[model samples]
Target: MRRLPWALSLLLFSAAPAFAAEGLDGKTLGLAWAIPFLGMLLSIAVMPLVAGRFWHHNRGKVAAFWALLALIPIALGHGIGTASQAVVHTAFLEYIPFILLLLALFTVAGGIVIRGNLKGAPGLNTILLAIGAGLASIIGTTGAAMIMIRPVMRANDDRKRNVHVIVFFIFLVANAGGALTPLGDPPLFLGFLRGVDFFWPTVHLFWPAALIIGALLAGFYALDSHIYAKDGHKWLDPTPPREISISGGINFLLIPAIIGVILLSATVEWGEVTIHGTHVAVASLCRDAAFVAIVALSLFFTPATSRSENSFSWEPISEVAELFAGIFITIIPVLAMLQAGTEGAFAPLVALVQGPGGAPDNLAYFWITGGLSSFLDNAPTYLVFFELAGGDPQRLMTEGATTLAAISAGAVFMGANTYIGNAPNFMVYAIARDGGVKMPGFFGYMLWSSVILLPLFAVVSIVFFAG
Candidate 1:
């Protein structure tokens, strides 16, 4: 992967249709960007079948290998095309780092304990659900999903028919829960980079997050009660209390790591960087390298056994590694395409709020764009819509607070809409399935969301964003 930097210059001057169109420079650019992205989508759709048939014996290794393959087209297509350098840099430096942060945190937290021996299924559900939500911002929605999923699944393992339980769990824990912090989800992380204050999401959206969780728990209780009643006879022996062990809760170190990275980025110069013609910060590169090294070292050297006597195995970590490797590889190209398209053809979307009905139109734009994010990649979806919101001079005339509020809120909240809306949803689903819980298919999962999540989000829309 280090060789990727070598191709940067070569990718810059490559000739392709994306750069050849006369009156459609933007369209050409969009297509070039799309090359890698489309590759990713295809990989996701087809890789499962291919891996299942050809590499079922070692899906993780196959997935990891293909993830690397997915990166090739993205690097070749976007790295050398007539694509915008700004978008490319943003994709790699800003975006990739955020993803990596969540990944590292998820891996670390997954090492922690979630006592599966607890009785009172509802109580277990509430605590795990709360933990998932609280951790979402720090770990990224996906990270929290990876950490909590096995335990959540374990808690409800016998209730196989109640798949909605898992689906709704994704809605709250993996998606909406993260809306309150940049660490929570990619969209908010983008906001953090674009001048939004750190801690802003927590201050603004905590209540809304609480409301969503409250509603979700209520729904879970009602559903769980019915399921428990049906499965009551089957609830034979509640697992005995055994200490499940974990390490790396060194919370104090996280603060310094974060500060050190920021300081380092501020001090060095990066590629294509220009600071009074001197250079941009190279600290980002160093920070990223150090961050990765620290995480790898911690995971490697940390004792696999907890002090309580329970031992750790690589099974869960291996599963996350395989699946996320696939995801990271495949999505790079997709993000490249989205970033390319966001500027030209996608520009007119900004005009949606300009004509006639004004603020109400903006509100509609908010929901529509945000709702789409629930199904699409919320990060880019966030950037596109954030641009749309910011592009409006009238919106600028309005309070900055209101404008930022709408953009950040929509991007963060609506991510809960689907299984793939945020990264963690898939991790949670994947981990649960690994524990023998049957996860819903693409559209089937949507059906579950519609029944449980939609109504609750609708309430949020009314209470918070219905201006």
Candidate 2:
């Protein structure tokens, strides 16, 4: 969800002016237009720390306030029709599908709980993390995290020092693991939607993803072993050792069904319908509808006991929805400026990625994309750089292979740099916290990533992007 606010905001603002007789050009728009978007980001970052109670209760209202600040000006400048159309375009074509997929995965995975009493030894913990990383590419980071997290938590329930376990889970399962496939992460899915081949990432990102995951797994093992030895392995096991079995098996079947619907949407172009002067793709509409149906099915068929066992609740998804609505609304102008390329207000950003000989710099692509994705939403950050590199999928896949790979690797891997770097990272954090893991505060988590993940990313950059 880290990228959702920034990505969604940029998209809605960019599209808002499209219906006007004379649309606002990014070249003509000034930096001041991006204030509301920045405000929304600041509110998200600072409010929770300064006014935790107020932020928790009124985050939706705060999101709405920032959104209105952006929209009111757009309506005035481009007329109400243009603003309305922009809202419709963003809602139908982007945000709805995005949220629905997350909802479906969360719901289905929540229903399937692993029943076990395994201890969380260093070797076992490493194996679980490895399994999760492998599953992430197949079922998505969100799905894999939802399915695996509770089991991991249950295994480590007796450990006095378990915060590092959850932190590394966020690093590996929730973010970096999703790099190898479109289904693995939202940014890659967006690339798929925009005409990048589905297997392109698989072909290009395998080694980079493997290297990072391997490094993290090794690092986590060393850290966990030290903590385990320091604690004298004297912690009482909460659940007596027993054979592991799975409950709510039906939901396992639903995971692939969700993936199928997404694939159907991408492969089958069923034409589109124009609503309020915005073209809505019928395939996307169908995909979203199917996701809703899947949600219903998961809730109906899976016994309430299973969900209860997983400690499933609606608060996380609800919070993401409310806050991201505002983000999507506020980011419209900033995305427009970036989309304007060299002619726009963000011309300096456009110029920064070019090399001395005027070609696109792969290292700059990796760092800039990763840096923004670390704080903002990686999906739109990937898009910004994708367009900066000329936005030709065919050319990017062929002649600019390294550049595309750099962008993809950066967007996916560096999202682990912070909890807000991706949607699953925060959800994993919230779940870990609720499950009694004293997860670090936002900055605390950043410190963990800074010490551990940053150096690994530097090595990756040198190996993959520096050439």
Candidate 3:
């Protein structure tokens, strides 16, 4: 389409340089630099429970307030060069591309209208989540989640106790199911971009991921069945079942375009464009350009009724974009500290992952990477651990295969531990809440992940990741 060419040309107008400066020296930054980041997370976690009305109405304002807390100090303490470089680098090299990918996936997937609601029987519910889990590897977790979540919700819309179902969906479809492929999750995709073979996760993580996914599905089915039986199974259907149909099928075409854009960026190299000391590949810029085209095309071509009928709203994506913007900016110091490794503040964190005789402890790698990823953004967490473990793909793939597998599984699987743990987790939470599912609040959701997934991951570590 003509739109595609125009969008490609949009890449010519790159982000204006913000003047390269010496980067934030994490070694010089005290633990106090992490205050904004921690406060931001606490605000997200506590503000909702304490001031539900205020948080709902002014989430963006809260996000901005914390973002400034992160920025102003850097400008005052470190100077404009460091501040500008940090924000610009994050905006260009990381956050924009991150948001664009989510936006394209969210737009394209949201347009798909699953026309009829089926009875949300335990058996049918299990099958739907299972199908969604299957699609996660192929379409990416966010896409799979966006496409499947509504229909699953619709089918269970009549149920009195449906919250658990959505929780398990978050666990399986949004997290564990994404463990098997680079395309399945952001962390693994980061791994792929860093020179891990494309099929590496698929091969190494298959059994461990399968075991976790299968266990979650089974647990969800059992829980749903028990709840359904308690509800007396004879409740009047809110909207009686109708013949299933899928609308906006044409929008599905954008999926491959999304995949192709990512693959193009990864598989090809173009000259670099440095913006504020961050060198972004021209190909990555073009990829972002292509995503803009795909989103526009999706919006223009898809029938408006398709989204309206599906109860799709832009609010979820808007909230995610706003909140994650603050997160990425504030997290600059935290990531830098981790990146500083042994020389920086969290040096003792380095020792935990090292076993007797200085060999890397696979299980410790799994737990620590997972624990940090449970709170920090998992993609960069994966990258940090990847560097700590020698940063050699060839060596990691062959001799340190188990260690690589542990990091991969931890980053992908433990992201379900909290709403903010994975991008898709929060998006799914917002959408479900909008759909009137009474989704759990931040810590409440953590309780669910702790009770269900933590034990399961323990089994996985013992079986597969033991050093």
Candidate 4:
């Protein structure tokens, strides 16, 4: 298992020398090329459900199989050069920065343990969720989740009906809460990189975000109150009352450092270097390097006891890194098709978002972007729709503001619809399972989202996106 990443890395590096001059043309690629990508998605969705034990032990092998399925065919058909460039480009430009940020946030947030007993009453739980939602826009969903998850878990440690609590937490804190700022979510950050103003989402998405978040909060409160009343409102305090204190105070400083690194990558113009035909941005490279340092800093400075109290482990992040590596690789063709616009295989999909009169259908854009985002990675999904809506940030921000708003809202809000909808959703699920929260399996969880979120989204569509 440990050798799997190294082995895949070696395959990519060895193939790079063959493809130093050319790249695959998405314009000519057929729909069949996306088979491996679909295979990978199915494996993720079905493997754990049908063969939980087998998947648990060999998930890395499964991911590698699908990745190789794509790589081998791509290399054979397009020459090793194109395949290698794709691999290198995805690895250096996309996957590295992505996993590094997750690593840094997970490490730093895990290091800061809030120590005290707090009752998981309906009011307290709602307040904590609200705080986490607010903090998400400032520190990021991953950061807020890591910082808030354990404390929320501890607060409800003795409760019988707490799965819904964590589910709503994922809906609000890990996904929806990140709607306001670029710092809040990766999709918005990508939009920022593409020239969407930093506060554009704040101005445009505020009402939509407020509507969904407020509805979810009120719904959660109602459900929690019912559960509390049914359980006789039992007061269970294992530890004696004491004021809450935080350890690993230094990690609080690292949060801003993470934000700074991200901002630097966005604001700075550091030029680019061509690596085997792939253009690697210097600012991005520097950001990833700083993330490595941040991870080390948190690990070195944080007390071991702090992470232990938080129940932190590398398994969750490792799982994400491995799984998403395959996803990023396979998704290349799918993204390419989407990027190809009206000439590509996804032209029908592009057509769906347009009205009969040839105008952009705001409601269709909202649901289509969101529906795909629920299963696909939302960041890239956001990029796809952004391009589909005409990739001019200036136009999207002004005259096409409604279209942009719909894409933004869909990507951020509906990400909570599935565990794979966003990166943090699975991490939160893993952490909750580690804490013995008995979280639902993939489809089971979606059932919850369908019941709670789908109706609210319907309202959002009608109220905000309707013609």
Candidate 5:
């Protein structure tokens, strides 16, 4: 309650008398980013102590607590009438369920795929992860992550030293590789909604993606080589390997269908429509129906035995659902305030980079944001930095090739900085835990990445991007 006065005073004193653009406050996009981000930081700092004391025994409960705290700022409406209304509505209605549905789809897909590949050969496992990462360009990050994570984790089973390899795999393949297409990451897709040419990022991000991929492949090979050399005695079995063909390779078809639905929804203008005489957005109705169809098809068509064999209980996904419930809640308010501050002028930093004298500084900001994303949720963090690169009174003036390149690089590569930075990070960690790898918690995961991954990225920064 006392905090309310301080917050109001800050807003009143700090609020501009007004802006030339009316809705727009006419501030630097980067400054606007600080609003929600500050809230995120405050939540992050407080969450650990709060959760440790009250929710000590339960990570799910702790996540819930923090997420609710994050929602407070958004709930207050950020002092903006219209934008705040939209945010409050989106947070409670759109965002939460969107996450849940996505999580559900991912869990189902991963469960189905990984169950069959539980005993996949080592080389095959490497190929699967690599292919999955490559496919992220086509599907979104979560799609590829869901399909490939279990197989990668299972393939690495019984190998203790090579666990971090999975972490890097999630960083590069599942997350960063998706930078090429709007379909790859949510922020880029949001860019697409705002008028970015869909194919542009793919062409431009190719070089940066290659650089990061090359670095990761080398790292994986080196790490795997060391592990293989040390563990050669246990490498092969005298008995011939059992064939593991997918029983429901047909079930996989549902995935593409799901993708098509999303694409169709994006393309069609289903303004407001009545469903059973109820008012709702046409786009939303399409989404819900599509997901329901996909889930129903998978459940009915899939063999009952296959589910049991794969341990396809709802438990693992339940955990992911629980974790994100909190994450989304906490970040909503911060995003609202940040959005209010920026007033939708957030993506012009790319133009600034190519502007008279901003490329070098803009590039530096990209690296810092990416580095931070490795620890923080890269979604909002990406937006923050993406907006910064956008420049003052930010606008998407340029094609965003260079800026998109930087955004892709940071959002994807730097996600390796921490386990929770990207959805794939948690997915991989969950798979490992289910498979018994005993992955580290928040900071512990960062420590490992900081010591190992960050230095390698530094080399990447110096050699490929900065140079």
Candidate 6:
């Protein structure tokens, strides 16, 4: 209430704000403001690989440090009131809701466990990958991976040459499969929150997703067949295989319940209320509240055996929450700069994506965004290119549909280029390694993506995005 003075000053400084929703002014800002955001992303990408133990222990603290680097300056320069607006606006609108959805998905997936083993024949392996890919859009990539990966590993545990199965799983289940719906991946959900329709990705991305996933499944089946033949077509069952048992069966229902709430939020309008000068929709409030409820309900009703069997812990979601808080805070200035378009510091980048006659080049949008998503967290990368292309959901969904499609596909699919690209990619890798699947090393994994995914992306670019 007392922050009106700084608020006015900051408002004045928003010389050329591109987004009506954005609070920060990018025209008056410079590249210096990007340091914290860049630092935060680099920490996420590099620290764990280089300083594994230190990162494990202090990742939360590191995130806080970068967030403070941005917040402290804002508070001092714009006044506590203005800085408070920045935090409140981004938190309520993007970060909190994003975390809540992920938390709900994480909790539900952890509760459901896949039991029993089957022969890891080429046909069965291909079918499992196909199922996981289909399920990715419903249960989320992380959830599907959590439920499906164990069965896959168990099925192929006896195979002498089975790394291809896990690698293909990482490509399809962990990344590309998630391209079809907002529930499938973090980036799409961010799009939804930013006013993209709940089914926008489903409609726009379905074909591209089908193309990549089908291609991956076909490639996987062929590779697995050759390998299976080498192993003498062994249908050799591993140990005493029991019929698949379902634990935490309640979570299956809860997942649809989670989706229902989000859908309701999108479908129904309940009005808006202002908090600290920012207006928030009632449906959004209800949706977030439902997520909290779902989390609690999932924890209470699901069998304890389900969690213990899955080795479930709060750590994964905890890390996600911590890292994203820093990202949402630090990215404010970056978005502002990108939003500024040719008038801002990122003119060169804007130019790079520009094609003949000043139109956005779909191919550039695909590769550049995907290239960055290969190393950076794909969610934030999506938001960056999203804002870069223009922050209007209406425009992006209509006249800019092809460009938006390119951005969405690139963010979701090329995340397989590196383990760090998406939350589930590295996770599946670590789990596979722990289960003794002989997963490839980081660069070696990139080599796989290079030989397999790069060519496929080229075909995608030619087929859908060439402009």
Report the number of the highest-TM-score candidate: 6
Which of 5 and 6 is ahead in TM-score?
6
Q: What is the lDDT of candidate 3?
A: 0.81
Taking the tens digit of each residue's C-alpha lDDT, what string does model 2 give over 274-294?
A: 876767889988998999999
The residue-by-residue lDDT of candidate 3 on 1-467, one tens digit each, is: 22222222222122344444567787887888878887877777667668989998887777677777888787788777777777777777666776677778778887877778788899999999999998788777887898899889889888888899999999989988888777788888767756788778889999998899888888988888899999844656677778999877668788888877876787887899876577888998998899899999999999888888766777666766777677777777777777677787867877888888778899999999999889876876787788678768889999999999999998999999988778789878988998889988888999999999999999999999884
Give the per-residue lDDT digits (tens) of candidate 4, residues 275-324. 76767889988998998899899999988888887777777677767777
Best of the two (1, 4) by TM-score: 4
Local distance difference test scores for all models:
0.56, 0.83, 0.81, 0.83, 0.55, 0.86
Candidate 5 colliding pairs:
67-330, 70-330, 74-333, 348-390, 349-389, 349-390, 349-391, 374-418
Evaluated against the true structure, the overall lDDT of model 5 is: 0.55
Q: What TM-score do all the candidates reach, one by one?
A: 0.72, 0.90, 0.85, 0.89, 0.70, 0.94
> Best to worst by TM-score, what's the order?
6, 2, 4, 3, 1, 5
Q: Which stretches of candidate 5 lie over 4 Å from their true place?
A: 1-84, 88-101, 114-125, 138-143, 153-161, 186-200, 235-241, 270-281, 313-360, 389-397, 433-448, 459-467
Which regions of candidate 4 fall more than 4 Å away from where they truly are?
1-15, 18-22, 158-160, 189-198, 235-242, 376-380, 390-399, 430-444
Range of the 10 consecutive residues with the lowest summed lDDT in candidate 1: 15-24
Off by over 4 Å in 2: 1-22, 230-232
lDDT of 6 at 269: 81
In candidate 1, stretches whose alpha carbon ends up further than 4 angstroms from where it belongs are 1-88, 158-162, 237-240, 244-246, 249-252, 259-279, 282-286, 305-344, 353-360, 391-400
- The per-prediction CA RMSD against the true structure, in angstroms, equals 6.5, 3.6, 4.6, 2.9, 7.9, 5.3
What number of backbone clashes does candidate 5 have, counting pairs of residues 3 or more apart or in separate chains? 8
Q: Once all C-alphas are superposed, what RMSD does model 4 give against the true structure?
A: 2.9
- Per-prediction backbone clash count: 15, 9, 0, 1, 8, 0
